[model samples]
Target chain A: MSADSPAGTHPDPTLTSLDIGHPVYAALLDPDTAFWALVDKTRVADTLAGGPLRDAYRQHADACRRELHALRFELKPSGVYLNPTERCNLNCRYCYLPESQRRSGGHMSVDQLLASLSRLRDYFRSIMPEGGRPRAIFHGAEPLMNRDAVFAAIDAFAGDFIFGLQTNGTLLDDGAVSFLTARNVSIGLSLDGPSAGITDATRHTWSSRSVHNRVLAAMNRLRGYGSWSVITTCTTENLPYLTAMVELFHAREVPTCMLNAVRCTLAGARDVKPDDGAMSRAFFAALDRTHELYRDGGRKLVVANFANILIAILAPTARRLMCDISPCGAGRAFFALAADGNLYPCSEFIGLPRFKGGHLLADGGIEAALTSDAFRSVIGRNVDAFSPCDQCVIRHFCGSPCPAEAHEMNGGMTSTGVFCAFYREQVNYALRLIADGKADDYLWDGWDDGTETLIDLAH
Target chain B: MTQTVLTKPQTQRASSPSPAVAPAIAVRKTCNPDGVGLSHYVLMDKKVAR
Candidate 1:
């Protein structure tokens, strides 16, 4: 290894520079140390197909493959995502939940919710005998629709758990605000765009009014009382304005921005998923603009998706962004507990019977579900086991993405994700940011994590 | 898709202190050998190191 090698542990052998996609530098993921760095395009041949250097690269790559394997089998729990009901007020075009289930009027009764909470508590105890509180994030098809059950579930756990609510935000009135605020719930509102024009088109509402105004009001109300963040689902409708949308959020004093690119998990999303090049450029532009604001405007705004990529690059172990983790945190770190006591790795996998772990209503079920074959199947998936991901340079940084989305869009969990182009572009762009010495601009920890302030741990 | 024009590695030592733990990050910043060192960063989201 050259002492001056960008990857200090891996030798950088000089060669003729190739005008590869990475341009001036090729970002290398050092499998031996699980570290990444940008080497001169001329020096990257050390790891490319050749002699001794290539042999060493292959050896380290094998080690990285094994590390991914370990991560997949490790079922360490961070929290649980609870779906109180399938009933939603808006008919969001990008909703991945089966329409039949969402309209079935099925819900977990207060008793069942309490029972589920009790089981969830037991799950925490099983995983952490030292007494660590688990996060109970009440997710949607408008979890607020089943008001009583959602509240009861919260009351049952009370101070024993950290709570969060991922809602459409239309139903978060004063009463709901007081209830969640009293319990210190971290609120994550889903608003696709900055205003009604883009949002209303994708997230439909039956009434004559706009969903954006309702959500904006909800955001303001919560921000006044406590911690809150907005999750912007990027699609073709909103792709062009991603940077502007995030800038507006920052201007409004929102703490964090979680940019979730629309995945082809369902028909609603498949139809609206942005073009690969468009999505990448939009997200990069968002990161670039927001990071500029965050740096110049006193480091208040956090573009979490961009920060997550940096974190995955800088410190892989500390990353909680599920989609970026190889094999993901799906069944291991968290599982989505549906309204009817059924469990899936995450909400996106809800209606898929093959991914169902088990029913939470069953005896000793939470523990049993964690060990179920179905759960294992989802958790056991690794990016290295797949085809092209193993050959790619940014495998560790991107994680190939959600298995549920992969299985839904493609054929299986191991198949190349539909977002491959999107991931490559984002990773390359992010690395370029780092190459330009702008990591600090987007790398932030402005929020106090002790209370889970605005940070969606499982997002 | 902005392509970075390849420039020869600068041998000039960066005045910035070497980042500890994750030296590759700082090393890549200036492409300087002296910039590599030890230390890790703590983001807002921290867990017990596995």
Candidate 2:
């Protein structure tokens, strides 16, 4: 088809732009061999499955329908993350939950938490069977600040749901450790780095040394029960210590570390992010250091973002990597149960004026989110709307641009992020790392025939 | 027996069968077609035979 014809607007015509020839357009019909060469069939399938090709072609159309069905998880909102109190002990500059949203001293009572979670339990009951229960995350000013409310909700939903908590480690003491272990709760701590210089600058409590000392002590105490890992942010303050950070985690024997760039928010924390170039350099440096440590046969450290892209290259089926799809896990595949018993799409987009669908306590939550016009508008618009992303060759493998970042930076889901340069740099670095034989060991060398085709190409 | 109980709730939430609505903009990008090459992009909004 000619470029003038809109992609996915019309059905497959008698001939395509890929078409070799048609008498009416004899000259135009000649195949664009150069273009055809660039089209990787595997990449095309990945893109089409999640792209405009969902509507353009008909052969795998049924499969496309199933993909849509599975992707749109029309289940009850199983998890609730309450910002029980909005005032955090450690005011992380990059905190997405703005101070305006914090409840501060106004803690959510046990009854309030129970009301929200009971609605959650009922919703899950309506969606999932007994054994295939739901899960929830505890968040807020700090889940630790309102530890009793957190446990009460956990206890209320005990047999029917799993509980996980995200806390800035300042308050993670021995008692907190004991409580989590006794209840089999998973914990994710926000610890940016191994050194005081890096971690203290971003996550330190009032005492400057409080966060570092407490986090280390907490890590030691919780080393035995349930899972605990660090959630790191690459801020300007922490960028210089990338290697030190990874080495610290390696030394601590922490199994995993999720490395994320400092996301700018409306929370009035502009200074929190490092200069773009510096941040990108630091991230790449961290990736390089981790590879070095791996060669030395140290504890495994995973940079989650790269791990995801590597998985796409190396393994497609290892649980659809989260960020590969749209960001802001809205009505698509995820649901978040908020403290107010309101069911929002995902936690990140929780406070957005445009995002809240309806309350779970009122009726079934899935229908409200699924049928809402705003939510549908997002789901209906695929990778077709933006620039760079719309034309990206790696669009299929990269998934689409994160909708939240796109919304924040571009003013709409249909637009590309203004600062997409950062992501582009990361992708380029990853490609270089993989091609340089650094990521060779991670690539699968043993899949046969059918699997070999996928694995070999990734390597 | 428990599996049946679990999946039952899923069955009740039947598909609403809403009609699909097309997006306002093109979802996929294609290459230029002067019979010349695939290397060039026209950035045109419409599709046509090369």
Highest-lDDT candidate:
1
Estimate, for each residue in A1-459, the C-alpha lDDT of model 1 and write its tens digit.
Answer: 111223224344322222326445555555323445455555566545455433444444433334343444443776778888877788888788887776665887888888888878876876764656767788878889898888887887886677778888899998998888886777778788877898887886745357888888887786654466678888989988898898888877877768878767786688888878888888878877886786687755777776677655544543446567666777776778988789887777887888888898787587778788888887767766678776666676777877877888888888877778887776666666665565556755421222111111110
Candidate 2: which stretches are off by over 4 Å?
A: A1-82, A103-105, A206-210, A224-226, A363-366, A377-381, A399-401, A429-459, B1-50
Docking band of candidate 2: incorrect
lDDT of 2 by residue, A38-78 (tens): 11222333433444332333333333223322332222333
With a 3 Å backbone cut-off (N, CA, C), the pairs that clash in candidate 1 are B20-B38, B20-B39, B21-B38, B21-B39
Provide a comma-separated list of chain B TM-scores, one per candidate: 0.20, 0.18
Residue runs of model 1 more than 4 Å from their true location after superposition: A1-24, A31-33, A41-72, A206-209, A224-226, A446-459, B1-50
Interface RMSD values for all candidates: 15.5, 24.1
Best by TM-score: 1
